[model samples]
Target: MKIIAISGGSGSGKTTAAKQLQQFLGNDDCKILSQDNYYHDHSDKFSGDGSVNFDHPDAIDFHLMAQHLKLLSENKAVEVPIYDFVTHTRKKETIPFKPTKFIIVDGILILSQEILRPHFDFAIFIDIAEETRYSRRLKRDVEERGRHPEGVKIQFDSFVKPMHEMFVQPSRVFATHIAYDNNSLANLFEDLKKDFF
Candidate 1:
């Protein structure tokens, strides 16, 4: 199995890029695992102040994710967790998944960790301007995550941008490809075909 990772800052189009690639690779041959699903359940520790630093790598159960990835690579089935973005916690249920010809892991911080980085055969970083990313994030958060616009802006300024600069941005050096914008996905698709096919 070939493991591919799509990593970028929040709202930088990682999911969009990953879905495009997955479609190109064919649904039957590719299995997608999102790092978002591995978010540690912090609902209990939730403060009314809204100071949760979710963008930090510490928020993820990387050890479990890496273990599951290894198991999948060995042709073993593993149970993947389900996370609730609104509640900021994991659900009790899990879905069983098996390895396939292509494994696409999508998340902002997948490439930021030393252990997870080495497991990827191909890594992509979607680069976007901060203003554009912030705009996209604002829309998505308000629409999907039930967040207020002002709260989104505050969180972005406080945690998201800092975490990206500290961990996500530097991790770009490890990516095999850098996509400047979503328009570049077609070219990236061809490049991936050449590399993987």
Candidate 2:
């Protein structure tokens, strides 16, 4: 099985890239493991004032995610955690993830974590302008995550931008490919298909 890590700043289209790759590879041949699901429960720490830095690597349980990846690499199935973004908590039930030909792991901090980095056979970092990222994040947060516009802006300014600079951007050096936009990602898909498939 090949493990692919897709890392980018929030709203940089990491999830979209992963979905496109999965579709290109076929659903039966690939499975996705989202790092967002591994975020540590922040219910008690939720202040809605951007005090909690969710963008930080410490905010996720990388050890558990690594273990799950290891298990999957060994052709073992695992129960992946289910996180509730609305409540900032983990759900009681988990989703069972089976091994496949390819595993696409998407997140802003996945490449930043040392424990998780070595597991990836291929790593991609998506790069985009701050303005584009912020705009996309704002729309997603307000529309999909039920976040207020004001709070999204505050959190982006306080945590996302700085953390992206500190953690996410530096991790770009580890990527085998860096995509700047949808067109780049599409070209990558063609290249990957030619090289791997």
**Cα deviation of 103, candidate 1, in Å:** 0.7
Q: Where is model 1 more than 4 Å wrong at Cα?
A: 47-49
How do the predictions measure up, each by TM-score?
A: 0.96, 0.97
Return the top candidate by TM-score: 2
Clashing pairs for predicted structure model 1, backbone only? none
Residue-level lDDT for 78 in candidate 1: 98
> How far does residue 96 in candidate 2 sit from its true spot (Å)?
0.3
Instruction: List per-candidate RMSD values in Å.
Output: 1.2, 0.9
Where is model 2 more than 4 Å wrong at Cα? none
Global lDDT scores for all candidate models: 0.90, 0.92
Tens digits of lDDT, candidate 2, 5-60: 99989989999999999999999999999999998899999876666788998899
The worst-scoring run of ten residues by lDDT in candidate 1 lies at 45-54
TM-score, structure 2 vs. true: 0.97
Angstrom error at residue 102, model 1: 0.4
